[model samples]
Target: MRCSSWIRVAVASALLVFTASAASATLVVPEPSDGIEVLVSSSCRDRLDVSLRIDEKSSPGELVFTLSITGPGSTRGDLRGFFLNLADESLLDGLSISGPFVTGSQLAANAVIGISTGYTAKSHRHAGGSSNPFDLGIELGTPGISKDDLQTVTFTLSHATRALGLADVSGQTFGVHAMSVGKGRCRTGSCKLTGVIPVVPEPGTALLMGLGLAGLALPGRRRA
Candidate 1:
């Protein structure tokens, strides 16, 4: 088959796959693939600019997550708490998490995984004055991740009975609280970062689109 003809076919296939994936409620980031990156899109989304990367681990029903700041070149902050909601509330009982700086846990109306060295109601209080609750909350210790850095904590989430999959955690609500954001006189005391699932074409989709465009340009280039 001609290169241009094959490129056309590839573009069509990519479009079909992209449409089908979008129709589903859950976005699957399969094992070994780059995890879904959820960015902070709250009032402080730009200022704090944090992100949560969720990936499926090798172990059955296990998922690994990393949280980090991603803007302003530099900043200073400590993650006070991390909050999330499971597909179902009952999953909370079997859920297990392990990470650095994780100290305690809390389950109120929703699951709150406390991750603080000195856990306190005052510290866990949601920054930005929002009362949104979560199915799980992780209280982190002091000296959290800072600018241009992915540090402080990397944790795994697993269940007991359920072999958790994309349906169990994908497209779920999540939030993070940070203290002392910014640096060199630009420091703000604290800010709340909430999850914003981005809608982007898969890499394959983008490559297909690029090929289709290139194919269209090829004949013109030859004629020139």
Candidate 2:
């Protein structure tokens, strides 16, 4: 085929695919459900937030998980360590934790992880408050977050793969259970906590859409 002919075909194919994708079924996020919550103390908040969300860009056998914890107090930059139990334990390697928190495990496993939250080694726990965005307390070797204010700590992990011991989690009923967190004035492990289960779209739907796009982009000739 001529260069101009090939170019025209490519443009037409791309436009057709784009239009089809736009008109066809597209993923839409559902209404937010009340996530799990925990308690700080009798004088503190009624509930603490422990939320989890899976990325829509997850591929086969891999998942992208983002977690956040909204506490009842601030002022104290106490670095809280939230111990969570993932649905797929082997896939733990795929997650990279961030925020005013640290991973119970390695930061980099088999995923292309990126983080831009707060961090302080257990060695410099209480001294690195000025280094973080939240001039809060550092609880490394010192006191944890104080009371009387609402504090939220969140983080994102991208490109989480299921190579270690898992696979695609699409509509597979995954969960993020809050096991425990760092110690502090009021919010301790003794505080009561509830787990959250965020839902994801079925993998079959995503896969069919992907196959359609692939077929459009790379159509094959048929013999008569």
Candidate 3:
């Protein structure tokens, strides 16, 4: 086989491995049978909408997440605290968060907020009242992601011991607390939201998979 053929094979092999390791997922409401509950009242439910997306980072043991909390056209509120569970409970000790900022995708940028983490969910008022004891707590500061102003938060999570992937967080429970719920029947106070993360296939991964398979199929030239 020619040197170029070997190079092509090696490159393709790496691409396959890299793409396979990188995964993505989104959060969804868990079913009652799952023993998870949303503490937000029925009236307040419409006042707050929380959505989170997770993607594998280029570096091993790291993942990036975008969390958006919004309300219906008439409803509005603020995100106060967020909570979640790790599939591997042991990862909690080594878990670290970075780059937590209000995403700049919106036209008018929101205020710069602070991010705080607690090992036990009970440390937060919202998560403490929940049925599930979340493993991690993320507390945001005042003027938190304003639902009326359309704001979102983005951050990265890294583990010290293991290489992180979509599987690490997929199907895990997540809880969110929003305050000042208004614009409807909801009283002016707080609401708790809980859900599970679901894995989603990334288009780029599919493309890389195809390219990798093609490269591996390439015919190698033989020396005469």
Candidate 4:
């Protein structure tokens, strides 16, 4: 009878731990389309690299997502001038890109491509003095993302401008254009941007799981 009780407790505890570990994360971009679009002085030369961080409470190493970029057929420009910054600041930046994914005829009907990067900025070209707002479209794959994980992305404009030499615009303000998908279509709207989200375990849930595990272990010890 004692052995059976111990086994039951152990099994229950293991189940609780497994469930807790499998808890889902959430990602939210609480803004309307028409996102943000900031106009930096022509003096800004460095291109911006973007990356997204999911679940700040969880190590960035644990969160992964596939990123792709596409553009309207009317959009014709060389994206090689920009790159993505994927360093320790993964939570700060979205994902980095190097070289143009679309060119000439490839820019039609919107195309998508994948991107990845590590620490430090990879050498790339800086936009010239020309004040052109390049329109780059992004798409994120939602296979493993959970509904509870906190998600935020950052864009780091690294490069020197003729006005500001070797400037790192890590915290500089920029405009963002917000957009959303509904009924299998995308729409743009004016969005009020805010700060990033923090992720952490629920205190009550953590406590309960801990106690359950302890109870199971105690029964096993007594049987021994």
Candidate 5:
């Protein structure tokens, strides 16, 4: 009977470890909307290009964006490129940009941009024409983030400029329709942005395990 009891205890302990490992391995996005949109500008014209960086806890992941622009001027741009890093000042390790496309006199600039791997939200800008590019970056910390925690980074633009023959200039209104990034590939027809899951373990889980081990080590003689 003693041997069988010991065996059962061993099996239970092993199962507990396995269950914890499996549960901890899976990363999840708790928010219903995988993506969040951040408005960057209300108006830009004369070929405006902007670049922004997104900071994440994980080493490598994916960034997806849905860009929208509205005005008489026909122009559109993608997420283009990104730089990521573990620290704020560290040299950028990975960078990626999307292929450029012309809006072709369309009323709106709507498109998707995808990026892979390491990047930092340090400095960003727009490329091309007499228009000066804008720089933007983001900082990330470990407060509410856990292995299962997922967050959305959003970018938005809402304005445009038009040239009115010779010295005349005109401005139009626009806004960000949507912006987001996620760990896994976005499924088709999904409007929300998704971000990659961080790899850190949950503090609560670790604390619970520590308590369990302490309980198992308690001596019956001491309790009595």
Candidate 6:
């Protein structure tokens, strides 16, 4: 193959990776199930409309959550990150749930160093009401956003599930009791933003996937 052809392939691959991992649509936050019995303060739940999901079929041993707000999103503060105390840790994969997964995508490039100071991994919280410390206290980070803007963030947990130990993880139930977020400077509407990323195929990915696939059907140059 010609060098130029290889270059095209390299560029194509890079775009695919970014397209696959970059963003997910904003989901309306769902209400916790009565069976789960973990009570996140009503005030927190009221602050933003949210939706949760556990992607057990498409991805196994991983919990995928999309928390979003409708219309103009809200801002409570600087809005660093969000958290949920695990009522049960058995759902988490002990080894795979750390590093970049802990921090937001913006800082994932330097996760190892970013985690310690950037945000809390799995720790204690009293302000929310003295929750138990973990085997699965997970925190997900976010790239900062403007107050009252439409924005959405998706969390892909390495090893978390809701089939057992709690209510079934689904649209009907979240299986969580407590939740919190870090808003360093902004408070009381200082930093809060939410929205659903539209589910349309990105133009770049569409062209790449479409043209690239069509290219495969055509003849290829023989190796030198």
Best candidate, TM-score-wise?
A: 1
Output the TM-score of candidate 4.
Answer: 0.18
Count of clashes, each model: 10, 8, 0, 29, 32, 18
Model 1 worst lDDT window (10 residues):
1-10
**TM-score-sorted candidate list, best first:** 1, 3, 6, 2, 5, 4
Q: Write the per-residue lDDT of candidate 2 for residues 77-193, one digit (tens) a residue.
A: 222333333444454444544443433333322221112233334422212111111111211112333431213344443345434212233212211222123335433431222
Candidate 4 C-alpha lDDT tens digits along 1-224: 00000000011111221111232322222222111221211101112212222221122222222111122222111122222222222223332322222111111111112212211111111111112221222222222223211123332222121111111222222122122311122222111111111112244543455555443221111110
- The residue-level lDDT of candidate 5 at 173 comes to 13
**TM-score of decoy 5:** 0.21
Give per-residue CA lDDT, model 6, range 169-224, as digits (tens).
Answer: 31121212112322333433322221111122334654555455532221232121
* Pairs of colliding residues, candidate 2: 61-167, 61-168, 76-137, 77-136, 77-137, 78-137, 99-118, 125-140
Name the lDDT of candidate 6.
0.29
Better of 4 and 6 by lDDT: 6
- The most accurate candidate by lDDT is 1
* Model 4 alpha-carbon drift over 4 Å, by segment: 1-62, 65-177, 180-188, 202-205, 208-224
Give the poorly placed runs of model 1, Cα more than 4 Å off. Answer: 1-34, 41-46, 109-117, 127-129, 143-152, 185-188, 196-224
Residue range 75-177, candidate 3, lDDT tens digits: 6656666666666776766777666442211011111121234222233443513453556666554443343332466667777777777677655666666
Give the alpha-carbon lDDT of every model.
Answer: 0.53, 0.28, 0.46, 0.20, 0.21, 0.29
Off by over 4 Å in 6: 1-46, 71-79, 85-95, 98-116, 120-124, 127-130, 142-150, 159-224
Q: Give candidate 1's error at residue 180 in angstroms.
A: 1.7
Root-mean-square deviation per candidate: 12.9, 19.2, 17.6, 21.8, 23.7, 19.4
